[model samples]
Target chain A: MPLLDWARTQWDRALGALAVLIGAILLLVGWMKISDTGFVSEQLPYLASAGLGGVFLLGLGGMLWLSADLRDQWRELRGIRARLDATADLAE
Target chain B: MGILLGMARLHRKAGAAVCAVLGLAIVPLISADAQADATYAAVAEATGTRVILTNQSIPLNVAPQLQGPTASAVQNSLQQSDAYAAFPYPGEEVAGIPGVVGGAAGVPLPAYPFVIATSFGDGAKQLSYPGIELRAESTETLTQSTATGGSTGAGGTSSARVARDGDDVVAKAVTDLDALRIGESLVISGLHAVATASRDSAGKLTRASELSFTRLSAPGFVIGLTNGKFTLQNGTEAPAQNDVPLAQIAAALSGAGYPTTFQVPQETPDGIIGAGLQIQTTLPAPPAGTPGGFSGETPVTYTIGLLRAEVAYTVLPTTPAAADTGVDAGVDAATGVPGAPALPTTDLAGLPGTVPVLAPVAAPVAGIDLASLQASRAAVGSDVGWIYLMVAAVGLAAVGGCAVLYRGAR
Candidate 1:
């Protein structure tokens, strides 16, 4: 039970780290492609989209890392709501 | 564990949304890149040798008139003579007829006959025409103050100032004169003028008066238009004149009209004279069944007077060898002509020179080489690719930031 609890606590952090790694890899690949092709405005739109994707990944990772504790709080709120519903049903 | 699963599920959904938006944005970019590549290929193809030949006919109508003091004398003499009293004004009707004037010995005045003739070169050929007569249509005289011996606005009381008087007169002819042809030079002589100058008590020049006799010589011009055939005057052969393409002549006519005056040497008997010629084009609508009209193909004839010669020029594109011998090409190695450099010849034993030693010449480069052109095309392609990469980088960063914020809110 203790190992399961530990795994639950660390899962969001693990996901956040994975997202950050993927984002960084995407950025590296985009830069390499640009350097190989040579820089001009014709290729701007594609490069822009790839860069936006990388930024989104980075932001998602950061949020996941920052809100690891918030996930626990959300779970607790759901549990409390369920107990309140059960009590209400008994009273009825 | 359930909460962790829920968070993972939300993250997956958000990632999927971001991917979808990014994919949609990239579709247009890919199409744009393809279009740009096509344009670049077209440009590369267009970089080649191109030759253009333009044939143009220029119509020039010039009537140069010589007018001054001498012409006024002839006009006054003719008007005052009693023999010409029957008709008040003498012009084209009495142009060639001689009129006798009384008072001093009888002087004969030919109203329309040319007073002067000019011959070029060895005097084998000469052109003669009468001076266009000028009847005073209108005259205006203006007087203004001119600053003399003083700086403007100096306000110095001791500065000496003098009032200067000037007269400007513009005169028009009563009737239009005949058109003059190219290669015809005529002088309108017998024009006389007298000028008198007046000074103030201090001997400073104040006023000047001039009386001039007007004699006009209309300048000659010829417009030659030739498509395939040319017709000459019955008794005359082609006069000595420059032959230019008909299109070029037309362009000249379309441009500004001929010069107001023909340049004359200062020492010439006529002196400096002001001349002007007017050209009116009378092109009727093409007749029915003409090529330009609703139908047919019989060549239409246009008769433009005062033309010396009609000619045409056929232009052909230069072959590779022909192009190589052009002015742009270096000196010819065989003939040592055109742009060939001359080197000093050293003589041995001061005797007659042996076979002349020639300098080595570089071989001429042919038409544009494709290798350099291809390299430029590649450079442009590479630049376009780099721009795409840069835009993608920026876009990915922005999207990543938005995604992070969304997750944080969740």
Candidate 2:
């Protein structure tokens, strides 16, 4: 199957890949910005923030790609338990 | 007492023998030192060197005014021109007097003079007018071989060798000074060397003598008067018509008591070439009781353009030949004399066999410094390596997490 078709069937994985791609692009942009800035000591903070943000996005994308469906199922279970408690309170 | 007398006599005899040997050795050393000093003195004398300056009057067509934008443009053009490089002179010094106005003595002056003062009226009495003095100089060298007679050394061996001699010629332009004016322009166009030669240290012909000529032009300006009363204008406009005939300028200069008839030698001597112009003028003096304490009757301004060409013939001393062992006698027969000029060859048909093979030396590559290469590599590794590693790690983690989720779902 074509990779695009597979990504359509598995949207979570595709979203995770897209997030990772974005992170990689951000990292490349950060590197280019730092190089253009001539590695000035005053610009280190901005470069560090950009690099950290890219890493965080990559981690979030990876987690979402892996367990996005599982996370939705856990939310549905919590909602069912809350409805059961409300029905018992009405019977009392 | 007899033993003591005998010992003292023996000591005196030994000391006298030592002194005699020392005197014999010192005599040869002193003689050799004196001979070397004499040889050096002869070389330093540089005898029979000749310097000649032949002046050829080159007529001026139009005197271009050097002032304002035109002056600046000409200066820029001269700076970038090859003539300026060939004959480099101080343009500022050429235009003004050294140390009289305000410039370091011996420094190269500008080609144009700076205007110091200006005044109006015909009777403005001034001692002198600010005028330009143009000077140009060139130097060339030639070498000639002369056979020196054989001189016997201590061993009675005849040392016949060739000696080189240097001849120098210096040519300068001469002009009379009665036709110059504050706003007048002067242009000299032709100056060159008639002949030149170059030879190697061995006195062998490297470059033959050739006849050649160089055209050089030096334009000048006269700015102001010295007594601070006469008006002098240094504008860009030509003092005379741009298309004015050369004969007319010559006539006016002649009427003003300046030499207009410039004569040229029927034959220019070898290694000598020069050209220049002379201008002279008498400005009317200020009337009696004029302001600024003026008292001169009539001040005359005389300017001359001097172009000099100097040629130097340099001869390097003969280097001593290495000692010849018995093994080189056969080689000497084929090579002939050590410092003799090589015979002309008509063709290269026998060159493949006669030519000696030489191993080529390795040449260093251009534009590649090892230190810079290493530094650049280190910079790329440090700046870009971590980003690539982070991206790779994130990609692998995402792939692994996705695989685990798929398995759990199954």
Report the number of the highest-lDDT candidate.
1
Model 1, span B110-164: residue lDDT tens:
4433322111111111122232221111011111111111122211000001111
lDDT over C-alpha atoms for residue B306 of model 1: 10
- Residue B155 of model 1: what lDDT? 11
**Candidate 1 regions with alpha-carbon error over 4 angstroms:** A1-9, A39-42, A70-92, B1-410
Looking at model 1, residue A4 earns an lDDT score of 67
Candidate 1 TM-score over all chains jointly: 0.21
lDDT of each: 0.29, 0.28
Which parts of model 2 have CA positions greater than 4 angstroms off?
A1-92, B1-6, B29-182, B185-277, B284-289, B292-299, B305-410
Q: Against the true structure, what is every candidate's RMSD?
A: 31.8, 35.3
Error of 2 at B326 (Å): 45
